[model samples]
Target: MATGESRARSIGQQATGRTVLKTHPGSKTAVLVALAALVTGCGGSASDTAPTKPSAGHRAGSGSGSDGSSAGTVGFDTVFKTEERFQQALPDPASMAGWTPRNASALIEDDPEPAARCAPSRDWECAKIAHGEANFEAFGEEADFDITAFVDKAGAGEACRKEATWSAKYTKAPGAAVSDVESHAYYRNVGGENGLYVTMCLGTVVAEVTLAGPNSSLDPDTAHSLARQFVPRIQKAAAAS
Candidate 1:
C-alpha cells in the first residue's frame, strides 16, 4: 500500500465532483424528461427487469443470455463469475449500431502508482468504460490499499483540490454500511476539455466514472444526474465479488 503523502497524491490525481440540472414536472413527454435529465455514464438499472444489452448511449456489456439471444449487459451484473464476463464489461464500438469509437484507450484501468500497482498478490479486477467523450472504470481487489482513506482525504481537500477552476461539486446520501459508500463527485477542465469525475469506495472496491467534453463549460446538472445513477451500480459491482 502507498504511504500517507504518496497515497494522497496518487488518489488525489485519480479521484475527484457535482452540479446538475433538474427535470421539471411540467414536462409532458418521456423523451422531454429524458432529455432534461442528462447522464454522463449511460446504462440500465440493476434490477432483473433491466435490459441485458447496453442502453442507447452506453457502450458496454457482452455475450448472449440463456435463451441463445444477445443480452444487453450494462452496469454490474451478479452473473459475472468468469474473466469473460468481466472482460465483457468493456465497451465495443462495432457491437452497437451507429456507434463510433474515437479514443477508447484514453481512460486507463490500471493502478495510478508506478511502483506499488496491482500485482499478482493484490489480485485486482478492473473494468473500464471509456470513449472520446467520457471515461468510466471499476476496480475490485483484496483489501490491499486503504480506499476509505482515499475517499476521506479526497473529501477533506487533502487529496485533490475540490475547486479545480470549476467548483466544489460533491454528491452524498445516507443508508449504507460503509459511510463513504455514499458518493463523491468533482470536475476539472484543462485546455478546451472539461471532465467530470466521481469516485465511490465500497467494500474492497473503488469505482470511478468521468465525463470529458470538448467545451470548457460542462452541464452541472448532467454530472449530478450521472453520479446519482452510477453510485449504486458501483456498489453492486463491489458486492459482486
Candidate 2:
C-alpha cells in the first residue's frame, strides 16, 4: 500500500545499490511490493539482475502425495470462495514454539491497477489474485519469520514461480531443496544480519516465508521444516474449497 514518493524512493534506493532500510513492522504488504519492484526495476546491474529462467531448485507434485500429503488442485471458485477461508489457510505462529504473531488484513487484487502493482510487469506474469500474510516475532530476541500465501488463477503457478525466482535472485540467495513441491530458497543479509527466504508453489498457491535476525538461530533447515508443515495446511484448504 506504499505509493507516491515513498514507494518511488524505495525502488530508487534499491536500484542505486543502497542498503534498503528495514521498513516498519506494520507494512508487510508494502515491503513485498517494494521487493517486487526491486527485482523488476533493478535489471541493469549484474548484481541486481535476476535469472530470466527459473532454477531447478526442487521438483515435485503439487501436494499430491510427494510430501506424504494428498492435497491437490482445486477450482478457483473453491480457493477464492471467501476471504476468511483464505486467511484461515495462512501459517499460524501459535503452532511454532515461542513465537508471537500479528496478521495483516488479507488483500484481494480485484482491480487492474492494484493487480498491476502487485507485480509490476507489462505482461503481468507475477501478479497474484489474492494473498494473506502474517509476521511473527520471537519471544525474546531480534528474530522473526513472515509467511504469506498467494493465490492465483487456476493453472497459473508459473506466475507465482517467477515472483519467487526474482526474489531469490535479488537477494543473491542460493536455491535449496524442499520436499514434495516446487520450491526455491535464498540466503539474505539485511543490514549485516543473516536470514533465509524460502518459497514453494502448491496447486495455485505460493507460500513464502522469510526468517531473519542476528540473535535467532533460524536457518534454511528450520524454514524448510516449517514449510513442510505449513504448506500442507494450505494445500488441504484448497482441496477442501
lDDT (CA) per prediction: 0.28, 0.45
Question: Poorest 10 consecutive residues of model 1 by lDDT?
Answer: 6-15
**Candidate 1 structure quality by residue, lDDT tens digits, 1-241:** 3211110111111112222233324322111011100111233211212123445554231111122222322222232222222223322222221222222212222223332342433222211111112222211100011122122222222222222222333333222222334345565555755565555443323344455544313334434444444444334333444
Cα displacement (angstroms), candidate 1, residue 9, comes to: 26
Q: Which prediction has the highest TM-score against the true structure?
A: 2
Tens digits of lDDT, candidate 2, 76-169: 3245423455544554432443343323334444331234454443232334445555454453223222223334444346555456556645
lDDT of model number 2:
0.45
Q: Which residue runs does candidate 1 get wrong by more than 4 Å?
A: 1-180
TM-score of 2: 0.55
Q: How do the predictions measure up, each by TM-score?
A: 0.32, 0.55
